[model samples]
Target: MSHTKLIRMTVDRTVEAEPGVGPDIEAWRRSVAGVLAKSRRVSPDELGERPEDLLAIRTEDGVTIRPLYTSADDVPEQPLPGQFPFTRGGDPLRDVNRGWSVMARFGVNERDPEAVNESILAALESGTSALWLAVGGDNLPVEAIDRALKGVLLDLAPLTLDAGDQAGAAANAVLALLDARAREGDGVTDRSRVSIGLGAAPLTTLFANNYSPLGDTAKLRSVDLPGAVRLAATAVNREETIRALMVDATVFHDAGSSDAQEIGAACAAGVEYVEAMLEAGLSIDHALGQIEFRFAATDDQFQSTAKFRAARQVWARVADVLGARDAGAAPQHAVTSSAMMTQRDPWVNMLRTTVAAFGAGVGGADTVTVLPFDAALPAGALGVADSFSQRIARNTQLLLIEESNLGRVLDPAGGSWYVEKLTSDLAHAAWAVLQSIDGAGGFSATVESGWLCGKIEEVRAHRETEISRRKIKLTGVNEFPDSAEKPLPVGPDGTVPDRLAAGRVFRYAEPFEKLRNRSDLHLADNGSRPTVFLAPLGPLAEHNIRTTFIANLLGSGGIEAVNPGAVESSGLADAARQSGTRVAVICGTDKRYAQEAPDAVRALREAGMTSVMLAGPQSAYPDENTDVSPDAYLGAGIDAVAALAELLDTLGVR
Candidate 1:
């Protein structure tokens, strides 16, 4: 059958289609309601007015994702790609066959300039189209720029720099190199073909450094802000394609800001830079052209896609307000989030980065950078990504673009009801956040006054709470943990580097990783992980559900759960003793719990069990069985981190 006919047949099978008539959406909804009612064992009337919300999900950004969407859903009229506001895309005639620029990030270790050069050459020779070089402070020395770019073709591959506090020196070195390449007439016939990003982000620097020198005008001016702007003006005068500044919202994202907050903060920072450049004697168009916006692409695919679209819409509004409506489409670069990478089971990061890259591509990012999976590991002094990891990172983009053909359509997510509505909602929400920031004396002022950090902290606290309750699952760290997995190689001292930068880094799995670290130390000292005795009160059919539940929960904290078959209350004490652990958990069905839990708890306690937990909720016990209480309940929605920490302490694991 033809592909079109097969798709039509599939849709026909999904909906209730009358013979010789079209498929009916109302019939489809009725069928769905019937299925839900039968599965839930309730009358169809009991299903609330909005049955879609039954499967709806609420995001951390306060956006609700409904179960289904149709044309009836309310959303603003969307224009074609490359239209005004540029929400669909920045270019109407984008080459569908040519995908986004695959950018590779290399942290230039001053101690190993040769290694950095080798990696850069390999990346460019492979599939990478651009280079994001971290230079200056704690990276490659500014003077070593020449050696780093020794064999690179400056005109072909784009170059971006990350130089904190040394933007002037770094820009000069790069510009000088480009000049020499042009003077030598070696492959650089046109300077406009060469793209360079100076990466001078003053607002990001202030946030990372805790708003240092705030309220001191002289000290603030003494920073590299003026020099960065002047360098950008020089690039414009020389007719070179160099974006001298960046509005990097990844700083806010790593600090745990929500999606709306990241977009709003980025827009505010862009406005701040525009005003500064205008004050430095540059036109609005030149200022906008000299700046690019960077955002974090996360594992949440739909949200990440919507975030980029919403960011473009909101930024266009900002530019229009500044009297630059014709040049409102902001250049965007998306990088996989560093905060989402986990040290334990770091291999899963590959899946996360793939999804993030897909979202960034569909969201119309100009460039995407996938950080290596092992970038968070402490293998070397600087944790440099191995060549294998870098190869995988670049190949991920290649597969998505070449094999999957993900870049063959412009605004692939456009015209979908759900994506359109989400884009509009996110745009409005982010605009509100930007308005608040502007009202509070703008981005820099908010950061200096601690307003931005305070708001981000509130969201972080809530997110952490959800993570502790397992509402937000970290696949390897907090869910399906492998206590027996071999540890990844570490540094010479076998220590993970302290990545805390002014308390701005907030890794979602850090709390659970800390508990695991303690467990590792105990195992190193005692030759066994902390053990928990799981007492099943009945046959496998009666207790297997809770048995698996409690076992996985305990394993998340690096604690082993030992099940010695089904033990009667009389044998509970002996089984506990055989396990050689002071902590125990009772696992059984509700009916079994009401019949035998009290005796089981009594037996374990009399045999000197220090702490006994039940694998169900406290309300599962009958009202009259007040004696059926375990010390703690290990069920859903409980704070797993706190409970595991307490169990480790009680068992002398620390």
Candidate 2:
């Protein structure tokens, strides 16, 4: 459980109010003002120039997180558990008591049916309660579904498929497998425990491939209604628990959609499916019952939990709008974000996946698949079952469920003002987006029109900017990188990633990864990696901070920083010469720069340094006529990728 009192922003003030609480609202305001005045050491009105501005912070989705929430905030009417709107949760008790299903992706290599069987069996034998088999292309061969699931007790574990273009074939293969493997003599198979979720996500295909699954973008706008209806009717006839339609947000979320964007996309997609199922003649309840939602559970615990909660609540509103009352209770499936997993310092991924699983479980996912830490690695790169990372990933889910006992609490994030407000805020934002999609003629129309990808690209562009500017921190790649650790040989020749062929993939660390690859290749070819000389302008005290800043910045791109200890301005050229580095970074305080940088930069450029960088804001240095202004500035918001790329190009590392 969480201790909210520690985090809640409260005031320390006492005032006697009317016994019936008349005018207590004013008293509360006074209390807040008193606290602010004391903290800011200012008058109540001024409060540090603009005190009200500090009360809220804006998110990527344009929702403001306020410092306080009270009855005055005008929140939308929240519903009871299992009731209309379902803001509290879809079900009264969501995945509590028993926890979420511990599912694994169960990657298979060699396109061999036997290899698939080994992977599934090993995962199941080691605490996995469900399977997420990603078939088609480089993943599990679609033809090997039966062989992969061979010997698996259908009564024990549920199976979900991410077969991309082959969803229909994979769904049929699952049904056939259950028919042949889970039965005896002439009686039907007891498949109540066999939860078969088929990703009938045409929108996913459209966004991922721009309509390669279907004939063209025009066909993508038209859902295969007959196929979906047939699958729903089959589930109804087989007397099995099969969710025929999947509203998967994992693809979009990993593609750099914001929390509200992913939730809105899934809700809108689910709405499209509901329309199809209803058109197929199933009742609203059954049509909704056949649908399940899948989203990415990331390491941002609060956002992950809030996103899951928002997904359920927003979809409930959509269902309500569609006249499916009980349909609000959607089954949520969460897999940790594969894009967040890093190839460098892969060991830290255990922490990432574990927290994500916790958030998914707490957020009310029915099933949570913790992808292996080396999930970024292609299968067989580290041998069968993805080596020890797979085992650790399984144990991560197990420990959270069994030892940590996260499932014992019902709606653990409920009741907190922060979480409740965020949940409601996300729902409203996501519903507006869903309405926009509906206004644009649903997922199919929007995707076919390319408007959907445009929204995603907009978000992706912002995210890429932040990532390159280091405004968004990636632990091992851009912050505290471990140079001693061996890099994971996890890609296609350490360059082109094969995952884009598998699904809609986007990674923030791709630029740095490419830089690392170049660095590795450079080292292999020249017997030494690219080096940049840090020419400090004074004693260590005068330049230590800038020196460290520049080194860490350059180090992020796998560039070796050659620090010729803090030297006089006169020795700057000699230091660059002695280090034999083609690039030099000037590090000093602004005052020191004003006094020494112009001469030092001139000398270094004269010494044949092709590219010169200054370690401060671009405005920190005055314009000079001596041609000593830095070629580039390495500061807080500068693009790390562009900076590193320029340095590498100058050093001839390409």
Candidate 3:
């Protein structure tokens, strides 16, 4: 036998702080002011007129991120993990061993039960610790659940079902399968260790179906909210580890709700579920225990981390108010946001998902699911993640857990001034939203009165405006787009299949992708992409920056920018004619534009150019009636989507 070498390390906890021994808050504030003053003096332009405003960033959720946070900030006294209010995490020792569970999601198909089983077994044999099966409604048929899970050991793998309207039927199917497995004694150990999430989300379903409780009360009642609550009670009585309801906030998030809105909406939904369960005769603690939460983990690392933390605090507060203080902490499952996924340049999605997974793990999610990078691709069917994509998704979490050891430290983000302040701010904002929802008569009432949907629409409009103005840059879609990339396969009708047939889902990149699709169709018909001639007024050095900017902007909409090198003002017309494109954009420095852009614009117009565009702002010309006047101005902060669509129309791409 070989002796193992055990290395011992020491830690120091000797310096204990008394009440009087701490950092000087007033001195720190003075130092911060002095630093800001120095920065304004040294780099006035960088700081702008209001240096303070430059330091703070306001999120879409209306949460302000300060430039610097210190112990001087008004942060609440944070309790340890597993304590009441459980802001840090639900479980104190959650990070000690395996950390968060790596969950693999599969789209079930009744037509191919054997294939689905093979995929399931492959995921289990790999690094996936849990399974989230999309069942019913174009997914696995309720009756086919047993066949779909043929080889899977029920007691070993934790299962979550996303059955849409068929949640009760799917739950019964799973329960039947579990009963069969128990009777067979198929390596079944403790039933208490077997976790099953029934996924009965009536509010989310109603929202997805766009059913107005006021106008469509029959449809609302048809959702069988009471049935879902009763099922949860039944599941709780059957097994301790079975969570019968899920407050899935991604439904609101995908519709463009902000972080606080998503959290508040989720909490409101949780309260609704708890109330329904109580009406169904389940105790408060049992009702709370039977509910799990699902949130969308975005690429915003700090915000995503703070969101999960704040969500816990908000839910704990709600439960405490409901007299279930001890059962406040519930399991949270984090899935990377599909809204952030890009159809163009899909490889970049891997980076996005990686960051999302990291944030979720650090934020203390009980289970993390990384959707495949190509999840946004038109895979011709719903829930269709190829084996290669599945492997990458599975390994993404494994590498984070096994190699990076991201979860070894408990509350890794705890004690940091920035995280603490952000968490506190988010908690307060989300709780306010929940209170508003309650005042509006809870989740169903808000949905019926259109108050909740109206709020979501307002945020969606803001997000779209920001995206169009390039304030919210989507890397592969609206920023550095790959126009030459080949298109992914679509359905037979040439349209991308809708993942959610009934619900509305918004992808940040959809507008740009639409333009790209039009460009692709044009390329297929004309043997070349819709081309825009770049008419540079000065030398390469002077025009390169603006030319590069214009080219990137054009490429984002799949338009080809044809640069015929540096040309004189006289040659602008010839260049436009030679390029054989009616649209011509003059690119040069502001100084150069003032010198030669008038003649250049006149030349392109006289050459029969339908649209003459300037790369710089309209103020560069100062006089709109002069020969320098372009049909449109293409510059920073211009609506890129509208500009590109106009250019495509002018070029006759459609």
For residue 27, what is the lDDT in candidate 1? 73
Ranking the candidates on TM-score from highest down gives 1, 3, 2
Report residue 133 deviation for candidate 3 (angstroms): 2.0
- Best-to-worst ranking by lDDT: 1, 3, 2
Query: Model 2 off-target regions past 4 Å?
Result: 1-56, 67-81, 93-97, 110-115, 134-151, 163-173, 176-194, 211-223, 379-385, 485-503, 623-627
Q: On residues 80-127, what C-alpha lDDT tens digit does candidate 1 reach at each position?
A: 777778888887876688778899877645546777888789888888
Rate residue 639 of model 1 by lDDT.
Answer: 96
**Which scores higher on TM-score, 2 or 3?**
3
For all predicted structures, in order, the TM-scores are 0.91, 0.85, 0.89
Every candidate's lDDT = 0.82, 0.76, 0.82
Candidate of highest TM-score: 1
In the predicted model 3, the residue pairs found to clash are: none
For residues 367-459, could you state the per-residue lDDT of candidate 2 as single tens digits?
A: 888878767655554454655877888899889888999877766777767777788788788888888888988888888898877787788
